[model samples]
Target: MKHLTLLVPDGQSKLSSIICTYKVFLKANAFWKNIHGSDRFSIQLAGISDEVEFYDGLFSVKPHVNISKIAKTDLIIMSALNNHDYPGSISRNKPITDWIVKQYKDGAAVATMCTGAFLLASSGLLDGKSCSTHWAAEGTFREMFPKVNLQTNLLITDENGIYTNGGAFSFLNLILYLVEKYYDRETAILCAKMFQIEMDRNSQSPFIMFTGQKQHGDEMVLQAQSYIENNLQEKIVMEQLADTFAIGRRNFDRRFIKATGNTPVEYVQRVRIEAAKKAFEATRKTINEVMYDVGYSDVKAFRDVFRKITGMSPIAYRDKYNKESAVA
Candidate 1:
């Protein structure tokens, strides 16, 4: 049997991630037993401590085993951490990081859900490996782990046995992925139906709310960002922006890329696309109208960029996210 260890961390962790992951693994084992006349996994919740609680003591969980006692595991799952207290959560669970690293070194696959990527990344196993996390935490994650490639657009990433999934509740998709990998496609489909989870959701881009990367202290870059955001309806010229900000074009490009993690033009396009997304969500405007409102005059150009950024066309985005559509 495959040994699956769900590493429950200390501090304010997402209770749902732990519980749901355990449930799904149990279901997978049950399915396997019914199919093969044997259990496929021996799953356990392993934690640094015996007990952990969250939500002001409304919920609590006690692990089946202490992490230090686990000599080896076939797979390790890191549950999502509370967004508001991730730093404190990571610090409190530092011991778990070492354990995770040691386990991976001894031939175990590690998977992280949502901001659980933070803990996985903390273990240094994700260095130079692609991973995904909650979209809202992208800036902070980039700042913390510069070496790890953060693929915020992807719903899940699997690299050398390290798996990660993106933002809130998307952990279900990762569980389905694991089910498919370990068991079979048929088993994963059954699990998906049991959980009512949509399978093969590989992109988080459509769900991302691009808030513009503004975490840096570069005053000039901030002003340039504000200018692009305010003038979304108008044509934005990069040279003009650099000249207006009294910075050389080369220096401006370099600083903008460094501060915002996007080139000047790329940043402008992201800002426009974000605005277009909001317009589609809240208004009944035609795709062209939304595109024009965001300063794209060419229809094909707008559609391509929108699809590239959101992983869907404008009409599809509207159909999926527009409030009226949801009501209907």
Candidate 2:
């Protein structure tokens, strides 16, 4: 049987990720027994301590085994944690990180759910590998782990043996993915039906709220960003921005990329896309109206950029998200 260790990290970990994953594996095993009269996975919750609680003591979890006791595991799962206290949470869970690194070096596959990618990235296993995480945490994640490629558009990423999923409750999709890999397609489908989870979801872009990246301390870059945000309807010129900031074009481009993680052109495009997203969500604007409102005059150009950034066309986005359409 494959040994699966569901790791409960120290500090405020998300209880639902731990419990839900454990329950799914249990159900998978039970289903396997019914068909083949054998268990496919031997699962256990392993933690630094025996007990952990969160959400002001409303929830508690006690691990089946201490992490130090498990010298080897076939797979290691890092459960999601509270992102607001992530630094402190990761610091307190240093032992878990060390253990994860050791296990991966020993040939075990590692998977992280939601913000658990933060913990997995900390273990150094995800260096130079693409991973996915909660969209809201994308800015902070990039600033913290610049070496690890953050695929914010993907719902799940499987690099060799390390797996990660996108934000919030979307971890269920990752679980279904793992089910298909370990068992068969029939079993995976059965588990999905049992849990009421939509399977085979591959992108998180449509769900992302593109708030502009503004965490960097570069005053000039911040000023440029503010200018772009305020003048979304106007034609933004990069050379004009450079001249307005009293900086050379090359220096402006370099600093903009370094500070915001996007070139000046890309930043302007994202800002415009965000505006169009809001207009679609809250107003009764036609696709072309929203497109023009965001400064894109060419129909094909606007549609392509909108679909590229959002994984859907403007009409589809409005159909899915527009409050007026929903009421109608």
RMSD (Å) of each candidate, 1 decimal: 1.3, 1.2
Off by over 4 Å in 1: 323-328
Task: Pull out the clashing pairs in model 2.
Answer: none
> Which ten contiguous residues of candidate 1 have the minimum total lDDT?
81-90
Report how far off residue 229 is in candidate 1 (Å): 0.7
Q: Highest lDDT, which number?
A: 1
Per-residue alpha-carbon lDDT of candidate 1 for residues 79-103, written as tens digits (9 for 90 to 100):
9998566677779889999998888
lDDT of 2 by residue, 109-213 (tens): 999999999888887888999999999998889988999999989999999899999998899889989988988888889999999999899999998987778
- What's the C-alpha lDDT at position 294 in model 1? 94
Residue 28 displacement in candidate 2 (angstroms): 1.4
TM-score of 2: 0.97
What TM-score would every model get versus the actual structure? 0.97, 0.97
